[model samples]
Target: MLPFVLSAALLEVVPSGKVPSSIPTASSTATIPTVMITRGQEQTVTPDWSRLSFANLPAITQSGSLNGQKWSAGQPVEKLLTLGDFQDSFKLQDLNLYAIAVATQMPIKLVKLSQFKLLAGQTLADLALAVPELEQLPVSTVKPLSDLLKSAKPSYRLTEKTLPQLLEQDPTLGALSFQNFDLTGYTLDKLPGLIHAPLQAFRHWQEAKLTDIPGLREMPWQQFPNPPSDSSMSGVIQLPTTMSYRLGKDSTSISGSSALGYQIPCAGCTSITFSDPPALQKKRWISGLAQWVQGGISDVAQSTTHSEPTGRNVFGKAFKVVVTEVSPKQAQTALYFRFCQFQQQISCSPYAIGPVPFLSYRNGELMPVGNLEIGTDRSITPQMLPSVKQILPTIPTEIPSTVNHWSELLSQILEQIKALLHPPATPTA
Candidate 1:
């Protein structure tokens, strides 16, 4: 939130002849009026060095009083000026007018102008003369920008009527932030003269509801001090010629030669295009134990009578080798491969395989069919090993029907994982 700092105090002086004869006179000390004139709510004034030490200390406190009694003691007049006339009479020398005017002009530096309260029907011209540096003027009625441009302030924000006027005076004034003003009814023939000014940043211009910006045929390339390295300026230059002609060739910085060759350059000088990975890579990987249960590949059928197989090695290979019976540890590896392939096909291949669990198989004792011994002289490739560390939960001695359910769940999990790894693309009808 913007801080609002109050400016100097205001005093309403009345002629002494208006004081009633019935009023009691001061004896040893002087008496001061306690009444004050207020436009809206009465505001409290904090004392500063100058105001605190003033001779009329009593009058200072009464100046901010809400009641009009302060002026009652002064001479009566035939008529009193309205608020507009009073504001019009404002002189630079008057401390009240001077302070408020300065406050209105440099609002960021000095916030609330407590002395001057704008009444209805006031225009920007009225405020501009008093506060020349003011970038904004909150007025009740919309007025012409020509009145505002009579002074050289960079910006002004008001209703719809004033926007065209503002643009007419200075189109290149960049960085406009406005709200609730409708431009739909107006026929915008062209953009303003100030469009050539380097517009570095704009806050909410894209969100605005402007139907036509006839001035913006070509892109504002020079506006950004440093554009993105891969940005293409061609589309910006090829905008409708109707919009271009209105902007005027002189008003836009882009030249015909530059617009002709605005294509972005890449490593191979080829236009970049993106595609999705093959669907076959989406299939799940089975662990050695799961593979045995699902009958994906038979351990007994593929194994040869070699050395003795024993202990944990016997059970480890029994569960893990296929897509359906895969363990969580092996499932993670398959998912990672599928994800990488889907995003960057060149980096991943269809030949990719998950880790093979090491287990022991013996002939005599309940011969753990489909299980291989850990110490067996079997060759493995670096590419076959999981890229990441395998985090295995306590291996279940008994396989359950729930394993199939888990496999189906893995498909959904892989889909979510893939979405995070890739950018959103247009959905096919």
Candidate 2:
């Protein structure tokens, strides 16, 4: 399967080698072949074809068919830019790797590519993936990232600006398209700009480090693709079918009252009636692009609240997301965040929380699926204990019929007290 990834870089030098007579040398009908030298080999190679080597090739030509373009179109040939053009090298990820083995002409060897001078601030390491010859260049001649300047360790690196600039230099260079080549140059945080990146047939993003960057979901792009409907890619669109949230701990827990239906209303969703014929379309669009998303966490939403352990707590439910993949599209991943629960949580435990945003392209246009919940784990429900009333220690409250009719007794006692206080009153009493 092809992935939509492309890249660009400097042309490599061809090593010296003896020419195989069967190989065609050029585009014109010349009798004598030309001499070309490669970089790694020790001998020179001579070929019998004209200087117009790949000019007559067709779209699916045996010469080389990359990203649907034949050698006759001259893109691959142009992408194999002259070594003198190295100061502004870009990537060529648009080529269909399976069909990019072009038989070269003589006097024009891959080795000649390495003789070009690099720009002042260019990172030579950035081109190593597309052109492995950079690894052989001496540190003095090929200045890489600042890290290479150190006397201790001399590992090279490309900056966030590296890829974008390379693509800017050559529009013909594919941005991230190497299917078989290794892209050790790019890091998780240093993704190439999407606007200049080329569309690919099959792309595997799992290899890139994408976990660290923030605001990844909202990156800008000139064009993006819609998710493909290929069943094999369905896993890429994983979303929660039902979402459950546990707000407060223990006695102070809050649970859905069932009657209200378990869901937090999505903002601006009041106008939507998801009835059978549905008042709203399942997808949303802005500009000419369709909206597709992978995440929508509470933090990215309107707001959220705190929770305590024992008092009445706010409990609510949110709807799960369902994402359908798009096709021929290059998607951009914008980051939200997540508290991983089941398998792996981003921040917290027991429940996975999040809306990890990712843009999908269909036919190279962004899919407008609206805010999607990209990350969702198991539904977590709080454990609660039954409530009980306290009882006083066993003191008997039973009384017989003769128990206390103190009305008469109280009157007698009052009279006796009065007589004692006053002697005349006592006599009358």
How do all models score by TM-score? Answer: 0.17, 0.19
Best by lDDT: 2
Off by over 4 Å in 2: 1-134, 144-271, 274-376, 379-429
lDDT of 1 by residue, 167-215 (tens): 4465543223112222232221111211221211121222211111121
Number of backbone collisions per candidate: 26, 80
Report the lDDT of model 1 for residue 41: 33
TM-score of decoy 1: 0.17
Cα error, candidate 1, residue 90 (Å): 46
Off by over 4 Å in 1: 1-206, 209-212, 220-224, 228-429
